[model samples]
Target chain A: MKVLVIGAAGMVGRKLVAALLAAGQINDKAISSLTLADVVEPSGLGIDIAHTVIATDLSEEGAAASLIAERPDMIFHLAAIVSGEAEADFEKGYRINLDGTRALLESIRLASQSEPYCPRLVFTSSIAVFGEPLPAVIGDEFQQTPLTSYGTQKAICELLLSDYSRRGFVDGVGIRLPTIAVRPGKPNKAASGFFSGIIREPLAGLEAVLPVADTVRHWFASPRAAVGFLLHGAAMDTAQLGSQRNLSMPGLAVTVGEQIAALERVAGPKAVALIRREPDAVIADMVAGWPKAFEAKRARSMGFVGDASFDEIIEIHIADELSGKVAL
Target chain B: MKVLVIGAAGMVGRKLVAALLAAGQINDKAISSLTLADVVEPSGLGIDIAHTVIATDLSEEGAAASLIAERPDMIFHLAAIVSGEAEADFEKGYRINLDGTRALLESIRLASQSEPYCPRLVFTSSIAVFGEPLPAVIGDEFQQTPLTSYGTQKAICELLLSDYSRRGFVDGVGIRLPTIAVRPGKPNKAASGFFSGIIREPLAGLEAVLPVADTVRHWFASPRAAVGFLLHGAAMDTAQLGSQRNLSMPGLAVTVGEQIAALERVAGPKAVALIRREPDAVIADMVAGWPKAFEAKRARSMGFVGDASFDEIIEIHIADELSGKVAL
Candidate 1:
């Protein structure tokens, strides 16, 4: 199966590529070729499959058309301006997140008009689609009223994905992933970066700042689980998704205190003590508006899985990112 | 206050224009000017206010920018391709319904960049935004999973409206109007056209076809009430609307049987007998998925009103459309 992964340079994108190469196949079909595209050329892949990497901006006119010219059997779209960046630069956010996604959908649609083509397009939506005034446990039927520009962009893309799928332009599946915890890399500037930092930094035997209160709770999944969601979404029967093409994937909902305890259990008190409690009201208010837990019955019923606990998430990070060995 | 109506030639748009002219002012401010636009030139309005009528396709490039150049203090955007038309022609549907609306919003946003220009943009959304597997009564926060392309377009526009408003690009308000009953003028080919035809034709001493069963229940509002909704939405304080600018307007929910009973009371047994049962499975299936009733507490709390009952709806039709007289 020929596959194309947009935004293939990002954290999840790189991991997903590795996972695909490791398996050597998807849905039991051998990977014949792969095409990777992003603003910056993706590197460090040691795959033997016929592959090509290109640096391109999908939002530019005709950019999406050029990408779809190859007509890959499956496309994984994970390109988006992160929340904080989108919120700061409104025009760039809408351009890259909203317009870019639309261009891609339109490209696929126009391509279908010329020939019999319906690619399995798996899009990565975000939990940011849900915002303040949320229910204690967000259900499958909760309304999407995103408070941030990034959230709004993702929400719009979800709507477009469903509409396009319903119209038979593309076979689309949107997975609203939880914040990836213990993200394996250097800490980024995202407000939710701390969710991973508190664990990843400690596991690496380094200091990490805890921005919010211990009572603060959030839904999480390891990067490994996120990649799993993409694979499952690519292979699943979209007929089961009905008219709503988007699904909020299952996640391990845990409090900061619970996360700390898990870290302590795994790496001893030294690792837990590395987390220093330092309050930042701006980040605190932003975190407070985020979803804590979700009743993702629809996604679960459809067989999409996640880490059962924070401990499992940490373990996955250690096994995958640290080669099953922590600094301690 | 200067006002601009994008769909001044349509049923509710004409009524809204009439209502505005009758009031001579909005929010106690004098109606200094009125700019009206539509696909076809609107005619036969004897208004003394400085007004201009133009036939324009909003989806065309530069059209929206031209309209916003005047920068009317209040803008009522009600332009759209109807449901059946949108379903039949996908490109035209997205072009006019989705792209057209976005064009208008973008024009306003760009204009604002040059100078401070946040106009009151009151948009006309529809109940079609909600589809099947619905609760007995849809609430203010029900998920929008539109089954039809028209509904999808409207739902997408609602998301864009909220996002633009939240970003301070435009002061926007979106009202999801229920099926406008007892519509004046010739019946169009819309499946839901029967809802108005069943009552309108009999009142005019003509036979009407009932395509769906009497047990089928749906939401309703008179053309007069729809006009009222626009006026109220325009003049009301939007400070309380928060980030979610779209509202499901209050409506009378009654079964087709109840509507028939009310018609019989308003006219006579002879008028009721004018209705002929003609089941069309296509329309019946479509109607089956429509919302029956809504718990529009948010709109009600904000002082938006609707007909109390089917009897009141019939009364409104007679008063507004039939010159306060029904053919007995």
Candidate 2:
């Protein structure tokens, strides 16, 4: 299938692109082409197929129509303003996250009215669609009372995806991913970044700060699992989804202490020792209300699997980034 | 306590306005005025307060700002495109329900930020916010997975209300009202109208078509009960709401067969004989998937209540609408 990846420059997008290319499942002859778009051109997003890169800001009026002009069979919509940015910049957040998605969905609906085959849209949502005062383990049936602007935007998009899919405008699947841990990149502006930075930086033999207490528990899946979710969503039968189109993806729940222990086992005491605990009162208050775990029975039944342990996640990072070589 | 009611010409709004005037619960000296606005002037509303009437189309850009210029202490937002109209006309629905509500909220937010006192916003949401294939009985905790465009708009407004409330811009409460049964008026465009028309029309010795089977079930409250829900939402302490600001109001759930039986018992067998069982397959299919009952424990604990039974609901219609005159 010819595929288009929106937000192709982001961490999960990069992994999905690499996975798709490495597998050769979508061939140059059979799949034919790929189109990648983002606010920034997806530099270092190297793929040898007939690829077009569009650095279009989608919130502007008419950007959506232009993007959907050459409709691909599958569209991976991974674009969103991160949680902290969304909470801070109200108008920009809603403009990009809510309006942009609606514009794209509208364009897709318009195009598919004439075209025989509408594209399959795999939307990456987040666990943040849930809010405070959650059941100890959040189930698929939990009502979306998103506590943050970022979560609200994602939940709204999920609603739109279901409605559009029910209307037969397009086949869509929404995967509400847990926070991707050990995110392989430089520290970003996301409030959740500390969850990843603590591990990723230490693995790279750099000092990392833990902003919350060691006992602070949270849910996580590796970036590799997030990519797997996208592919799995693309391959699933739409008929099974019916009207309820979103699924809360499966992941492991562990505390900061557990994450440190896992890192020590995998990368030696020196790497773990590089981590310093200096709790920021602001971040501690924020993380205090975050969901600790999920009872993702729906996702499990639908065949979406995730990392069994944090060690496996670290190993995946090492094998991919360090070429299966590690220095302790 | 100055009050403004949008869609003041609509059924629930008219009732609520009447209730507010009749009760006169606000300190007479403190409450100087009330403002009622709609696309058409709200004539014969029978309110004694020093009130202003505005016939303005809220979809216009400056309408909300002008409406809020008086700076009412409380705003009751009841304006929306009903389900059928919204489903048929997507753009109009989005403009009126989504954009209109956003404009009003934005105006209120601006007013609050510029000055000291933010108005308390009492928004009338709907059970349409919950979609099917739902659980047999939905609870207050049920996630909003709206099956219709109107519902999607309500859900979006709920999110905005929550975000605005969280930021201390405005105190907002969204009440998800059940289908108001025994609506004393000519049949309107709402698909759920038949639920009320079947009983109300038949009680008046008029033949009414039952569009769905007797086995079909739904949740409902009397129009009087709806007024109570709105008033309680307005008067109750919102600080008790915590982060889950919106609530599903408690109502009775009954099957159509049971409703007819209740009508027959209250108004004699002749009223039941006046019911025509001409099932419209389209409406039947639509009604079949709707939530028949709700576990509104949160609202119940918070003191919102409804008629105990369909029989009681029928009596309410007679006592309230028919002015204590029951006809067999």
Give the Å error, residue A236, model 2: 1.6
Tens-digit lDDT string for candidate 1 (A1-328): 9999999999999989998889878889888999999999999878778899989999999999999998988999998889999999989999999999999999999999889888999999999988788987999888888898898899889988998998888999999999998887898899999999999998998899999999999999889999999999988988998889999999988999999999998889999989999999999998999999999999999999999889889999899889999886
Global fold similarity of model 2 (TM-score): 0.96
The candidates' interface RMSDs, in order, read 1.0, 1.2
Q: Give the Å shift of residue A223 in candidate 1.
A: 0.4
Model 2 lDDT tens row, A162-240? 8888777889999999999878779887778888888788877789888899998999998889999998898887788
Model 2 Cα lDDT, one tens digit per residue, B1-328: 7889998999999999898888775534345688999989999987777999999878898999999998888889998888899999888998998889889978887776767767889898999988887988997777888888888888888888888788777889999999999899787767788899888888777888888888888999999899999989888888989877788999998999999999988998888898888879888888877888999999999989888888989998888788866555
Task: Assess each model's interface with DockQ, reporting 2 decimals per model.
Answer: 0.76, 0.76
lDDT of each: 0.92, 0.86
